[model samples]
Target: MKALVKTEPGPGHVELVDIPEPACRPDIGVKIEVKYTGICGTDLHVLHDTFKNYPPVTLGHEFSGVVVEVGSEVRRVKSGDRVAVNPSTAVVCGTCEYCLQGYYMFCPIRRGMGHGVNGAFTKYVAVREDQVYKLPDHVTLEEAALAEPLACAVQAIEELTDLHAGDVVLLSGPGPIGMLCLQLLAAKGCRVIVAGTSQDRLRLDMALRLGASLAVDVTAEDLQQIVLRETGGIGVDAAVECAGAGPSVLACLNAVKRLGRHIQVGIIGKEVTLPFDTILYKQLQVVGTLAHSQKTWVRVIKLLNQQKLPLTDTITHKLPLSRWQEAFDLCERKQGLKVFLSYDE
Candidate 1:
């Protein structure tokens, strides 16, 4: 098998090299033939040594695949079943309080699939039987490849917050995760305003197409004015920050109405100075969210089953495994939205 491995600790140590194929063992649970894997912001971070990652490990986690073989202990899914994986399931302490509650992301001993252990950047991957969620016939492998990110959005919006239909939402960053959350909020009948810089022109346009009530380019337009006008001077009911930039975080804090929600979905890698008084004065329900839970995955699959969202609208690029660097560049340059990679099979 060919895996895209991070050979060493550096800005550019990734290589597409041959490695031993993961065998289907009773302890490993299941073996899957990866069909499509989506490039995520975390993958880019790992590439640049910005995110915590182990060396000599495969570097993808957002993927969908078919079960090629199942260990003797595996009974949840058959060999021919189409499935999506739970990234956090690869390594976790099952006895922890967080894991006991199905929130593996909070487990102290948790080491996720992509950065923590070997991931699915190649033709095959081995996963625990419980981590494999059987995909419905209605969902294509490409669409399910985005399930990991969609699950993260589900955790932020559906599980953590108190947002409801008819409420107003201000979402910053028109990137892939932001776009996914926009559609989810839209489906809940929330009128959303998407904010971005001039570089996000294409993404901002797609945000409107995905159901944002307004898309404001922060560089040229005033987001505060737009939020006030859109809400009739009341401000948005909730402000979600997805850009992870300091400006976007402050904008969400400033635009959200007093006592409203401000959900942090983006992973801000470095520390930045923030207005500490904003939370105190506004009395806002500020929430910090991480990865998805089992419940979150359930909601994601349910949402996909209904087929109400136009998820594919955000998929702007697709390339083969050999062109993974091109896909990475497109994402880093913000040239497109979701980029899917397929193996040579």
Candidate 2:
């Protein structure tokens, strides 16, 4: 099988190499013939050596596949089942406090797919039964590849805060995750203002098409003034920072209503200066969210099954696995959204 492997520790050591097909563990795992895999921001971090990753391993997490073989104990799925996988928190100590509480991502020894172990950027991948969710017939394999990221947005919206209808939301960043957040918030009846820089013109336009009340180019316009005008001189009821940029975080802090909430979904690799006084005076609640949970995945799947999310609009490009570099370049250059690497027919 051909797999995109990060062969060693460094800035650029990734390669497409032939490797042995993974065997399904009869007790708990299933072997999947990968269909499509999405190139994510974390994958870029891995390529740049910014995120923690296991070398000599495959480098994709957001993927969908068909079950070619399943272990005897894997009753949840069987051969020919089409599925989307939750790459993180797949393997964990079931007895740990976090795992016992259904917060397996917090388990002290959790081993995630892609980073901690071999992932789905290949012809075949062996995954634990618990990590796989069978896809509905209505959802295409390309859409299933989006479920993992959608689940992350679900976690941020459904788990991180108590949002109500008609609430104003300022979403920073018009990337794939941010666009998903906009759709979810809109479905919940919240009026969303999507913010991005001039470089994100296409994405900003897509956000408006996906129900964002307004799309602001922060570089070209005053975000604070727009927030004030949009909210009748007050501020947004809640703000979500999804750009992973320092300026975006600051804008969220400044534009949110006093005592409102700020949800951090984007992974900012380094430390940044924040306005401590603003947070203290405003009594704003700031929270950080990581990957999705089982509960989140359930909601995400439901949304996809119901055809409620506008996922197709966000998928701007799709290339074969052999053109992995081209896919990565499209994402890094911000020329496209939700780029997919097709592995099989």
Candidate 3:
């Protein structure tokens, strides 16, 4: 089996290596023949050595595949079943308070797949059976590959604030997660304003096509002015910062209404300075969210099954495993929105 292995620390240490195929552990794990795996922002972090990742490991966490073998204890899926994987929590200490309450990501000893262990960037991967979700018959494998990211978006929305119909939302970044947030908020009847810089022109345009009420170019136009005008002198009910940039965070702080919620969904690699006085004066509710929960995955699958998400356009490029460099380059250059690596080729 050929896998994209992060063989060492430091930048760009990844390579395509011929690795032994993973064997299913009876009564615990299942072997999947991976079909499509999406390259994510986190993968880029891994390449740059900014994110925590184990070396000599496969490098993809978002993927969909067909089950080739199932452990004896895995009755949820069987051989030949199509499935999407939830890779956030591969191992957890059940005795931890967070784990006991079903918040496995909060468990101190938790080790996520693709980072803490091997992932699905190969022809085959052996994952714990509990991490697999059987895809519906109507969902294509390509669409299912988006489940992991969509579930993260779902968690962001559900855990952030109580969004009501007709509420105004200011979404920053317009990147993959930001775009997904735009679609999810729009579907809930929120009038969303998607904001980004000049580099995100195409993504901002896509946000409008996907149902954002407005798209603001933060570099050229005043985002605060647009929010005020759109909200009739009031600020947006909630703001989601997904760009992971300092300026974007400041913009969200300025655009959100008094007593409104501000959700930080992006992963900022370094510490950022924020306006503490504004948060205090406005009595703002600030929340920081992590990865998706099991419940979020269930909701994401339902949304996909219902054909509610505009997902086809999100996937702009697909390349073979051999062309992984090209795929990574496209993503890093912002030339495409959700670049997928197909193993079937």
Q: What's each prediction's TM-score? A: 0.98, 0.97, 0.97
State the lDDT of candidate 2 residue by residue for 207-242, as single tens digits: 999999899998899999999999999999999999
Q: Candidate 1 residues 90-164, lDDT tens each?
A: 889999998899988888878888789999889999888988999889898888888888998888888899889
Error of 2 at 23 (Å): 0.9
Error of 1 at 241 (Å): 0.4
Clashes, model 3: 0
Total backbone clashes of candidate 2, pairs 3 or more residues apart or in separate chains: 0
Candidate 1 — which residues are off by over 4 angstroms?
none
Q: Judge candidate 3 at residue 291 and give its lDDT.
A: 77
Per lDDT, what order, best first?
Answer: 1, 2, 3
Deviation from truth (RMSD, Å), model 1: 1.1
lDDT of 1 at 308: 86
Better of 1 and 2 by TM-score: 1
Shift in Å, residue 109, candidate 2? 1.2
lDDT of 3 by residue, 170-212 (tens): 9998888888888889889999999988888888888889999
lDDT of 1: 0.90
What value does the lDDT take at residue 93 in candidate 1?
92
Judging by TM-score, tell me the better candidate of 1 and 3: 1
The true-versus-predicted C-alpha distance at residue 125 of model 2, in Å, is 0.5
